[model samples]
Target: MTELSLIRNFSIIAHIDHGKSTLADRLIQVTGGMTERELKEQVLDNMDIERERGITIKAQTVRLDYTASDGKTYELNLMDTPGHVDFAYEVSRSLAACEGALLVVDAAQGVEAQTLANVYQSIEHDHEIVPVINKIDLPAAEPEKVKAEIEEVIGLDASDAVMTSAKSGIGIEEVLEAIVQRIPPPQGDRDKPLKAMLVDSWYDPYLGVVILVRVMDGVMKKGQQIKFMQGGTVHLVDRVGCMRPKIEQLPELGPGEIGFITAQIKEVEQAKVGDTITLAKGGATEALPGYKEVQSVVFCGLFPVDAADFEKLRESIGKLRLNDASFTFEMENSAALGFGFRCGFLGLLHLEIIQERLTREYDLDLITTAPSVVYRLTMTDGSTQELHNPADMPDPVKIDTMEEPWIKATIYTPDEHLGSILKLCQDRRGIQLDLTYVGGRAQVVYELPLNEVVFDFYDRLKSISRGYASFDYEQIGLREGDLVMMNILVNNEPVDALSMVVHRSQADPRGRALCERLKDLIPRHMFKIPIQAAIGAKVIARETISAMRKDVTAKCYGGDISRKKKLLEKQKEGKKRMREYGNVSIPQEAFIAALRMGDE
Candidate 1:
């Protein structure tokens, strides 16, 4: 076992596209973790979607051996975390397992919204942060300006910041040296009982459940009995290992070491992230402070395009949940979309990632409903309920008061785009909290309804700012609002999947936009199909899909006017009767198109 002083545990934290993963690649290569032939870009990002999007979804850990200038080998455990706000929980968990963090800043872009957010989290975890100004090779890079911004905005000293171009292999040696010289080693005692923190876990087809752990107090070895403190489930450890970006078997992991273990656990749910693991026979009496349960903010329904694929969809979702514990789902059947499941996600990006994974990995076609935020409802009977789906809402008369979730959002944009960005936020019923100028950029903070920002707000911000704006938000608790459920009816029948909760003041415009979009999406039927958006007994918007006429008078050529009139009347009566009994067969494409109204 290596001495505690020779081991360093740290994570790389930065904003999206700020070269966190690239820096990881450079470190792994220089330390000879992988040979040149086997090395590639983004070696830690294993998922196809992650590589394609050039973003890290899951935080990856690797153990590297580096020979410092003093001729001493040090064991460095580096966690490469995601930079997006949707994956902030991943960053927090990584920080909890590390003693320090490399705060990477884009030399050209300077301090962004996520950069500040992540740095604050690192400070909260009491991590020793070493600033690294990355991408200095860029033509617009100004390392000195970025260093000043780090000191002014984040309050972190940047006088000794390291300058490196991760892509070109510049200043890599200094980065490794700084990690060894500056970051402190983890503190733990091997003589105590086994107390390891479960950082993350995923399901492996070959090995049931693969758990990533950081040993805090004692030794974790193969063939030992361990218990999950939160779950109270015991299992026999089958294997113990570490990742060099590839699995390397180890006989035992001592204190202050990061490694993995397979305990013959059946599912990842049994091995909760942030849970304390200890010896089953003689474990610690008190558990460590674990992470809070993740709350899903956005809710939407996922239905198979074909009814026959319902069972397949269920199996696919269950398997996906094995790896992603933050994603929650429940079996729900919709009248309009047939059998499906209602899934809850942390945010819009999380929902998109899950949907894309289901379609690409499982090869299943899906139709997603409109996304909505959770609401708290107080009943006249002095009871409270959380509303996930609008279709499941209680009677309006029984709802004494409704409170919708709110969020505190911070946006960083260039000075030129500040006008449009502020207008966009204000148009969404936002209350501006503060606005300040940092260098040539503007930082704006606003309190906006979570529902308004859920639909296409990020996309709009990106487009208006020419992709120069960075946005991040945290959910503040719910507040009382004049919210009402808007229902969409096709053929005078309400579609549960198309229902949503909206603020009363903006309900009319939102309802009208949806009704108009559906008018164009739904195909022409045999009889007139009247589509209406309504709240309670009042209709807010209406549209009609004209009937496909057969031209009953076509065969009455050269006939008298009276004969043509009689035939037309007969056909009109038949059409009216058919309108009452005919069911509008809305194609799957229509549902998909109508739900994407936010894009328009």
Candidate 2:
């Protein structure tokens, strides 16, 4: 076993597309972690979705052995984490397992909103940070400017920050040397009873459940009976190993080491992230401080396109939950969309990723409803309830007050796009909290309702800023708001799938837009079909799809006016009867087209 002083655990953290993964690839190459034939770009990212999107959704770990210039070999545990705001929790968990972090900044892009958010989390965890200025080969790269920005924005010392081009393998050795010199090693007592933190777990077709763990206090050995401190489930350790980008079995893992363990666990749920693992007979009396439960900020419904595929959808969702614990769902039936699950997610991106996986990985076609945020309602009887779906909202009269979730958003943009960005925030009912200048860029902070951001705020922000602006936000709890539930009616029948909760001031315009879109989407029937958007009994907007009229008078050209008029009267009566009894058949395409808001 390696000495504790020769072991360093560090994670790479940065903004999206800022070269975290590329730098990781360079480190693995320089350290000879794998053969040149076996090495590929983003080797740690094994998922197909991650490869296509070029974004790391899940945090990945690997163990590498490096020999320093001082002629000493060291064991390095590297955790490559995601940079998107939606996966911030993943970054946090990865940081918890490391003693230090490489704070990567794009040399041309300088510091961004997400960079600040993640650095703050690392600082909170008391991680020793080493600054790395990446992409120096880019034409627009300004390493000095970016280093100064990091010092100004994050207050981290960047005087000795390593400048490197991860793409071309420049400064790769310097980065490795910095990691070995600057980062501290983890401290643990191997003589104590076994105690390891379950960092992550996932299901395998052959291995059952594979768990990634960080040993804290003692040695974890094969064939040892271990118990989960939180779950209280005991099992025999089947295998002990570490990933060199591929699994390599080991006899045991000592204290301050990161590795994987398999205990023949049947399900991933049994191996919870952040749960403490220890020897069943003489484990520590107290458990480690685990991670906080992730709160899903956004929710929506996912239904199969074919009604008969509901069971298939259920199984697909269950399988996905085994790998992703943050995603949540519950059974709900809608009159318009049939049976489906109302799912919860960390953000809009998380929701999109899950939906895309359900479609691509499971080969299932899905219908997704408009995304919504959780709201808290206080009743007249002093009771409170959380509303996930607007269709399930209580009557307005019974709700004493309704509060909507709010978020504190930080936006970084070039000065030229500041005006449009501010206008976009104002249009979404946002209150400006602060404004500051960081060199040529403007840093703006706003407090906005989560419901407004849930729809299309991110898309609009990117369009208006020309993709130069970066934004990050954290939920600031719920606040009282003038919110109401707006329902859509087709032929006087309410469509629960089309209902949503909106602020009072936006309800009328929003309702009008939905009605107008539905009018164009619903096909012409034998009788006129009326579409209305209403708040309770009050109708705010209406549209009518005119009937397809057949000319009965075409064959009566030579007949008298009375005959023609009688024929017309007979046709009108028949149409009136049909209007009273005919049911409007709305095609599936209509629902999909009408739910796409902000496109117009």
Candidate 3:
């Protein structure tokens, strides 16, 4: 059994692209957890998409063995977490498994918006934070300046912060030494009942569902019966193993240890993140705190290009969900796009990742409609209703009031772009709350409607600030707004999936923009197609795509002008007849092409 004093459980937290993954690689190498022959860049980021994008989409846990200068061997479990705001929940779960964290900051860039946000989150979790300045070998490296910035912005003492260059492998030994000396060891009671928390999980073809958990109060071993407290399922533990950079079957995992458990679970739902794992026969009386069910904040319709691929898409989603439990989907049918699934995601990045995964992993083409936020509707009869898709909304006469979700946005940027950033925020109807300066950087806070920022706010902010600004936001309670439901009509027929809720003030301009975009994308057919945007029964914008004309007069070569006129007359008559009876076929790309008409 490993002694508790020699076991250190910690996580590395930092903003995106700040050398977190590279530092992780160096630590894993120098510690001999994995041989140099087995070493690779971003080894913990196992996903191909993650490696290609240079971002950590999922949390990875690894065990490392290091011997300090004090002549003592220590076992370290490092939880590598995603830094993007969309994966904040994943970061929180990773932090829950560790007692300490390495706060990595870029030497040149200093502290960013996400850096402070995650630092405060660590403070909330009461994790011991050891500030580290990375990328010191860069041309712009300013370790001393960053150390002072860390003190000013995060209010943490950084005089003893480790300065290292992950690229050159400098100070790698000092970082490991700091982990052994500064970061406290994990503490728990081995005599207590089994009280392990499921930090993360994945599905394996041979072993079924595999779960990575941190044992808090008891021992876990193979052939033991375990109970998932929140999932309310019980099963016998078929295997218990620890990840020594690879899956190694262990005899038993005791307190303060991080490892995996396979309990013959066929379905992923049985092992949920944030759920407690205890003995089935005599489990602990109370479960761990801070257990929250993941909720989808943004929703959009995902239709296959070919209607026959609906079942294939559905099966693909099921397999994806076996690993990722954050996204949700349901059966949906669109008048223009045919049958599909209405999917829900944590945020825009999550939505994009899922869409890309569906295309790449399942080999199916997809068309996604404009994303929308959930709204709360009040009926005239005092009944409350939850609305995800605008098409499901009731008539205006039967509605009393509608409430849309809101968010608290925080932005950090250089003082030079303050004017443009503030203007952009105000244009989005963001209410300025406070503004302050810290370490030569400006931090601004605003309360904005979630609908406004869900689509174009990030892109616009980056454009206005020249990529110097960083953003982070959290969902606040819903607020009442002057919102209206805007519907799109193609060929005089309303598209249910294309309906969206927008503010009444900008509805006309946005609707006009959508109509114009659709006109350019929709192909001309035998009959002219009129695309219109309307609110309730009133039309707001309209555009008509002219029909494709054929050279019927070309066949009348070497004839008199009268003969050409007669041929034209005959072609017009045929077109008129076709217009009366023929239907316009709008391709799937037309609906998707209009989704980029900005946030409405």
Candidate 4:
């Protein structure tokens, strides 16, 4: 085994919007992993939803080169972790890939809820942490105050933490030197067989499954046979690729190096995150360290606006799932939505990413329902079934017992919004556990059912709190609840997007809003759309979406009969595209926007 001193590894950890992606961009560029010409802000984050929303949804690794103050060139592996609680498991996996972490605290915002959660997680993972105050270039920057907060929270000295503006490129050099000095290098047996943990992977039009792996032992070479441990699959090595910051196709990978090895792996599940990739007969260590199996926490239904596009949506999801391990799927048939899939995700943001990618990246028009959390139901006979769409929920009488997942939710917000935040949490069936005061801000921890946060809670929290509330939650366990699964129907047909599991009392408002949103989102065609909310047999609420009444009444009047006939044909084509099976008339943006929204 090589000594650990040669490998320098660390992860950039922070809350959403805290410059995690920006700092990664700087580190990658400075380390010469990516060239100026190849530089794209947030290059490590590839998902469109992630870049557009200014957050890192998955953890990414890029190897970089740096020169110490004494002129020694050292290899620095920078692990960029997701900045939200929904992705805490991901951050933990990233932590396993490194020996140290750069805990980024926003200078202007001080320590937010997510930042604290990640720092604690890093500590729990036993990775040495180096605190850094970012956004120092902002006019309201208070580096010293944040430094003190970090010291107080992490129980470490604050002097070593550097203040830097990743955007202005200030103090970046110093930060680089600090990483080399504070973080230790990777140590592994070079003589053993090759074994590495798959961290993140992406698909390029040219190179498929551009995988990022942290080598655990031995060496990887071109044209070698490999097997994935978790899924028990094998791949014939195509070519070994190295990314010394900017990606380069290489002939081999040694211990301590972070790179990719592709072997024409067509199926994404075969090569998955946290899976150990080793030689078929023998490879380094014969086993890998620190691979965590990832699971889905949130679920949603994906339906194409045009039923004919059902097959198209399914194909897009399959391709999307190739590189995105967090997205999963099972075919779902809805009396309302027709044939679709009940897709699983890591979190709400995860669900949105898949939906957006399908509509925006794949150029497929779709209608997604309100996001929902899965419920574990134990039948009276002890049989178990996990519920995703509310429609599939067994009848309450048959269920005998149902345990909805609960999360220990921590909401951080300014003092002014504390009362509203508390009230909102309480109304969502949240049980207040504790509240802490930090400067003029507050952090409130509560235990709430996952069903609450999966739907309108996210939107309501942001709205009532004026976007000041930051949220983080990890599953605590499940709790017994008098729950009702609210299923929505259009013209008496169930639409998966409108399904939800709501408390008995809140069902009315949730169903009303869901139906209204559907009425606005589902397009109008030759027939009007009727949206209804029903709890089993009886309908509690209903709304209507009318067909297009006056679209293009003009063209036929000024043209010849044949031309007028052509116009009618074009109009019919337009209707076919806009029409859904239900009683709603909507446009494309409305469909995408509806998917982007959650009715609180």
Specify the highest-lDDT model's number. 1
Query: Which regions of candidate 4 are displaced past 4 Å?
Result: 1-4, 32-36, 204-207, 283-292, 487-499, 508-600
lDDT of 3 by residue, 395-459 (tens): 98998899999999999999999999999889888999999997778999999998988868888
List CA RMSD, all candidates. Answer: 1.5, 1.5, 2.8, 8.3
For residues 383-443, what per-residue lDDT tens digits would candidate 4 score against the true structure?
A: 9888877777667788887778899988888899888888988888889999888777888
Candidate 1 lDDT tens digits, 1-600:
999999999999888889988999999999999999999889999999888888888888999999999999999999988888887776787789999999999899999999888889999999999999999999999999999899988998999999999999999999999999999999999999999999888888999999999999999999999998888899999999999989999999999999999989888878877888999998888888846667888999999999999999999999999888888999999998999999999889899999999999999999999899999999999999999999999999999999999999999999999999999999899999999988999999999999999878998999999999999998788999999999999988999998999999889999999999999999898889999999998999999999999888888769579999999899999999998889898888888998888784
TM-score of 2: 0.97
Q: Lowest summed lDDT over 10 consecutive residues: which window, candidate 1?
A: 285-294
TM-score of 3: 0.94
TM-score-wise, the better of 2 and 3 is 2
Alpha carbon lDDT at 452, candidate 1? 93
Model 1: clashing residue pairs?
Answer: none
Off by more than 4 A, model 1: 553-561
User: Whole-model Cα lDDT per candidate?
Assistant: 0.92, 0.91, 0.89, 0.77
My TM-score estimates for the predictions, one after another, are 0.97, 0.97, 0.94, 0.84
